[model samples]
Target: MEMIVSFILAIVSYMLIDNVVLSRFYGICSFIGVGNKVKSAFSMGLAVTFVIMMATLVCYPLYFYVLVPAGIPFLDTLVYILVIASLVQIVGLFIKKTSPSLYKTLGIYLPLITTNCAVLGVVQTNSDSQLDFLTSLANGLGTSIGFLVVIVLFACMRERLNGYNIPKAMKGVPIALIVAALMAMAFMGFGGMVG
Candidate 1:
């Protein structure tokens, strides 16, 4: 179906081209903080993706069929954030209890994801677009894939950059920003291919 194809493209775009952290700069905190190593970055990416998908799944229906129809649309912003935060906490606790190793590896990143803009962004977008449940799930899946792909790619790039020599003015975050900007530019190549 057309929706399926669009969902696929959306996932591909988010994963390879419109990455939340690298492309849109949504969750720069985790992007920079957890990107020190591939393992940590992978964990962070998966955590964010999982949280975003869950948030969207819950938030979209609440906004469309509940809040809007009840004439309490003004409360949507607060409600959405509350839902996302609550869900993230629940998931974090569940993960911590169920998988101690993953919990240790994810460490603070799991909690840090509670306020990630990328997760909020997906929820808000899904609500605004009025996508059906299936489409929303597809969108969530796509966005997570995008985030995962970019974070992993960034982790590798950062690892490689560690051995490079650079001007003093362009060290640390400055160099990382420059590399990220270049990566975004490269992702633009996919724009034409999406539609």
Candidate 2:
């Protein structure tokens, strides 16, 4: 029962308190750039979630059993980049083949997932913390869900704000940045819940 509770707590804490974009500030580039349209943002969120989960699935065991045992833990980051690049290629190809429009909409950001800090952050965090496979997987899922929530909500807010009249200085990126900051602060309020 304690193990089950821990697993659940991991998910809740990450999703609410330590959100990948809003709290930890990982993946902010894509979070801001591709977050203007709800449909596109939703697609990006799902893609990211898939990559994080799949990468965690592969990286956890590979790092603990292989890298650490070989006494080559320093190569972990390089290995992780390779794995992430390969996964991004796979995702890009699949998206291009199945949904040409979304592929076009995502454009550079799709491939940018290879370098996206959030994707790399979760995988590296798992290894750095030496979390067991199940716990690491739970962490990945939590972060992914948090990413989805923030991006989708941000996109929705942007969509709504588009119709409103705004001052010259506070329009466009300025407004978006303000909204994101407010969101970060709001998510920070949940810190007490987990800690």
Candidate 3:
């Protein structure tokens, strides 16, 4: 019962209160860069989510069952990065094969997922904290979904911002950053709910 409750709490907390983008500020690169178009943002989100989840699936077991026992846990960061890079390549190939337009739209960002700190952070946090397998899985899934939600919403907001008459100084990245700060605050308000 306690484990189930912890799982549910982990999902909700990470998805909202402990958001990877807004609160943790891990994947701001894609959040601002690809968040201009709704379609592209959604695509990026899905891509990121896939990479994070897959990385978690492989990383958790590999770390606990393999790395720790091998007495070389210090190599975790390098190992995780390599794993993420491989997953990003797979996703890039799949996306390119199925949707060339999206592949082109995502362009460098597609491959950049390998460097996305959010993916690396979640995987590292799971291992560093020594969470059980199920809890670690929950944390990874929740954080990825949080990334998806925030990116899509930011994209939607940016799409609508075009209709508004904005000051010259507050245009482009400036306004986006302001909006993200506001979002971070709103998401942070939920933090006390979980803890």
On TM-score, the candidate that comes out on top is: 1
Error of 3 at 97 (Å): 4.3
TM-score of 2: 0.90
Model 3 C-alpha lDDT per residue in residues 1-195, reported as the tens digit of each score: 998898999899888988999888898887888857888787788878888899999999999999999999999999999988988888788888898877776666777788788999999999999989888889888998999999999998888899899999999999999999988888878878987
In model 3, the runs with Cα more than 4 Å from the true position are 97-108
lDDT of each: 0.79, 0.88, 0.88
Name the candidate, 1 or 2, with the larger TM-score value.
Answer: 1
Off by over 4 Å in 2: 95-109
Error of 2 at 174 (Å): 2.2
Cα lDDT of model 2 by residue, 91-133, tens digit? 7888888987777766656776787799999999998888888
Using lDDT as the measure, name the better of candidate 1 and candidate 2: 2
Q: Sum up the clashes in candidate 3.
A: 0
Clashing pairs in 3: none
lDDT for model 1: 0.79
